[model samples]
Target: MTMSFGRFDLNLLRVFNAVMEERSVLRASQRICVSPTAVSHALARLRELLGDELFIRTSTGMQPTARSLAMAPLIREAWKSLEAAIDPPRFEPYKSNKRFTIAVSDFVTMVMVPDLLAQLRRDAPLVDLVIRPDSWIDLAEQMDLGQIDAAVGVFSEVPARFGSSSLFAYDDVLIASSSRRFGKLSLETFSHLSIAVVSLHGQHEGVVNGFVAERGLMRRSEMFDRAAFERTFTGSKRSPRVALSLPHFLALPSLLEGTDLTAIVPRPLAKLLVRSHPLSLYELPYQTGLEKVSILWPAWNAGKAPQDWLRAILIRAAEPLSANLFDFVRPARYASPTSQQEVAASA
Candidate 1:
């Protein structure tokens, strides 16, 4: 008797990819536009065929098991190849009618909106574009699930597992009334002076907070010293102070003018405010260096036509405003998806 291999369902990989990408069966069903029952059945078939449970249920969604961990990269690569094989042969930038959705913070929008819009109008005139405001959204997850075409902003909330690359760097500069300098500021100055800060989530505990706290503690420690340096300056013990906490970066400029209050903002915003409002941009006495902004996407989208096209457009649009002008940096482009074997080995 001749031995023959049974044919396996190829669509099962699509179901598995969706689940792996979204990390939730219900969300995966939504992405694939199939019923949850259908998704579950497809996943069950995949589990039996691969002899792995794939993902174990968790409070924070499904966590991939060791076996599933070892299979994800292969699945991703297969999907990329499948997409390439099935994709339309040609894409006419000006003629093809496709809508793209992008997520970006208002700060990024303020800088790149004009040029991005102009480029779209000239190159992909018929292509519809939707610009969604940045929120506390899981952009990487969303990209993996085909929820958004691309994101243009800082990925501070992105998880380490996701691949990302730097788009550019901009400094965070201090702004205050020119005449309101209090000689040399002590941490006690923090207790006296009101400062404006920006955070998208409205939770102020990242770089800005860390820098301030470190300075505050250092200043407090130095106050007790009897050195000549301590004698040269008068200081006191006081709590860190924040008078008016503004959530939006745009509102800081108007709030700082003519007031004793000071605001720390991105260098570009500070420059704009200095030109518009009666504000002076001063380098923070503390050395919080320049900020680096990045663009991120799912590793699986590397070879897909739509994703490849979108990334190319973004890079092209961002090129003219390179390091010389906006201190842009070429981000690490992951040409291949991270293998599941690698992930499993790391674990």
Candidate 2:
């Protein structure tokens, strides 16, 4: 029972992984293109060698034991490392039917996804994309477990094990219904009006002074520049009240139309919304620092061809928008009604 590494079979790991993923002996056999009898024999050999029942048959399905649960992640990571070492480093985007999963915010989906999809369709017709919300509490864990390939958003802190690249930078701007014919948004007037904000966690407060630390990941749960808002109203008696806290931007336009509610959002997203909706963009009464939107991936995937290819496409897609971001953030007083349309067209 005390077998050395030299005598241990590596193929058994493949069978184990298949069973672990499928959670059923018959399904696992089908996944590996092996007969159920061979899968059963392999499992038996592994169980005997390890002195543990890795999985137990139950009414639901093949349930993994405590030992299996403990070993699964390590075994899977080891197999991935082995495969990466043995396999040739190449990715043919045009011919291969590969699927990539990305975690993104709704703002990024609105501004960037269309261009990304257009380029992807032209360059890699067979490649597929799966988009997940960035608000998931387990986003970092999912990335570590290989369930998510990459994420796009503003990360306050990225662990050293991950690699990041800035796609673009933006600042905050205020938006209101154009019908209001609002003049300059002085600090006093801005503080008096009701405000709407896109809060991923539905938090009422707009002041996110620092990152929300959760499970080894540092993320921004609030969408707007809350710290700047707090600084602008440090000692004011009538501070701005967040009248609405919505989860996504889809309902923001309808909610703001013909209403006194104004929202503080990223400059780029504000420009996009103003072009289509009856919204008017305004410069924040107080200056806010710029925030960079970035894409993050596992550090180990740095030179992998698939990751490199996807990164290249993403950078190319964002280049035009990045170049014109300054136009979107210009002072609202100096901007003309048609400026939003022109900038949006160029982007």
lDDT of 1 by residue, 1-347 (tens): 22223576777888888888788999989988999999999988777767778889999998878777567767767776777788744677789688888877767677666667788789888888788765555444455455676777653455533445666666554567655655444444544556666656454342242221221110011101113212333364553344665445677766766788887667655655566556665544333344556666666665566667777777666654444443322242111121223223432
- Please list the residue runs of candidate 2 whose C-alpha ends up more than 4 Å from where it truly belongs after superposition: 16-30, 35-74, 203-210, 328-347
Q: Output the number of the TM-score-best candidate.
A: 2
Structural similarity to truth (TM-score) of each candidate: 0.60, 0.84
What's the true lDDT of residue 261 in model 2?
Answer: 92
**Residue 325: error of model 2 in Å?**
3.8
The TM-score of predicted model 2 comes to 0.84
Q: Report lDDT (CA) for all predictions.
A: 0.60, 0.81
Residue-wise C-alpha lDDT for candidate 2, range 222-326, written one tens digit per residue: 788878889889888988899988878889889988898989888888888988887888876788878888988877667779988988898887886689767
Q: Which 10-residue span in candidate 2 carries the lowest summed lDDT?
A: 331-340
Candidate 1, superposed: residue stretches over 4 Å from native: 1-6, 16-76, 101-103, 130-135, 143-149, 153-165, 176-192, 201-240, 244-247, 257-259, 273-280, 283-287, 319-347
